[model samples]
Target: MAAVAILLLVWQGVSVAGLVPRYMLPAPVEVLQAFWKDRGALWNNSLITLQEAGLGLVCGVSLGFLFALVMDASPLLYRAFYPILVITQTIPTVAIAPLLVLWFGYEMTPKVILIVLVTFFPVTVGLLDGFRSVDRDAVGLLRSMGASKKQIFWYLKAPSALPQFFSGLRIAAAYSVVGAVISEWLGGFGGLGVYMTRVKSAFAFEKMFAVIFLISAVSLLLMALVNGLERLAMPYRKVKQEEREDSQ
Candidate 1:
């Protein structure tokens, strides 16, 4: 918090000192004022973006998890799909967004697709890595105990993979909103990205600054949400009292 305060103080000092033109980089106060004034539109647009992101994230994570299962179950599947998945990311997101909008029209479909595209890779890779990282000895022990493949997966693999899954979720959470907004940038009726495009065209620097800050805040909030979900999902991952004492 102090660091943020100090940075803001330095920013205000720079603006007050006229080190840069206000039009180019508005003062934080100006941005704040603009944010407050535009709160209604921002709130409405934010809702649309948030919805797109939320839906996309669910779809992305689900698909990625399933893909991980398939790949982890078969080495041939992994060899074939892994390279293709990595290759998909080589195509720039900006390039893909326009095509998705063109194909899907200006509705929410394209925005959600963009989000899925942005989010899925991390999750798929993370879960796959997690599944593969399981100790071979543990699997052997489970097999010796006459555990079925399904039983082993349910009791061992999934649980062991959860930490990495959550880590991927954190990354996906950050990407989801940004992806939705960027999709909106190319074509959308309303969203933060649309608002930003209009503000930039009109040379509303203060408002642009305000929206940028809002976007960052939204991304951070999403990440915090993912972190909370991680705790809930991995409740057995308790911190030992001895570790706590050591830290203290």
Candidate 2:
């Protein structure tokens, strides 16, 4: 918070001192005023963007988890599909977004697909790494005790892999909103990106700044929500923290 304050002060100083044109980089207060002025439109567009992001995140996470599980269960499948996943990542979001918009029209479908594409890789890779990181001795012990594969996964693998899953989720959460906005840039009836395009065309830099800040705030909010979910899902982490504090 202190760092942000300092940065804001610097920005204010720069604006006041005329280091840059007001049209190019408006003062924070000006941006705030713009944000307040356009609150109604901003709010409506925000809801659209949020819905797209949320839908994409859920689908992306599910698909990634399923892929990770299948790959983890079969070494050959992992070897075959891992490269293909990597290749997918090489296709830039901006490059494919146009095609998606062209094919899907200016609907929400393309936007959601873009978000899913952007978010899927991190989750799949993170969970796969987590699954593979399980202790060999522990797996052997479980098997020696006549544990079923399902039992081993439930008792050992799932818990062990949760941290990695959440780590990936944190990244995906951030990507979800960004992907939505980027997709909106190409074609969308409504969204922050659409609003931004309108403001930019009119040379309303202050309003553009306002939407940019809102986009960032939305991304941070999503990431924080993911962090909250991680805490709830991994109560043992809290216990570990408490134990460490007690030790100290």
TM-scores for all predictions: 0.96, 0.97
Model 2: per-residue Cα lDDT over 86-143, one tens digit each: 9988999989999999999999999999998889889999999899889999999999
Best-fitting candidate, scored by TM-score: 2
Write down the RMSD of all candidates, one decimal each.
1.3, 1.1
Candidate 2 similarity to native, TM-score: 0.97
Clashing pairs in 2: none
Candidate 1, 79-114: lDDT as tens digits: 999989999889899999999988999999998888
Lowest summed lDDT across 10 adjacent residues in model 2 is found at 112-121
Task: List lDDT for all candidates, in order.
Answer: 0.92, 0.94
Which regions in candidate 2 have their CA more than 4 angstroms from the true location? Answer: 246-248
Model 1 stretches with alpha carbons more than 4 Å out: 241-248
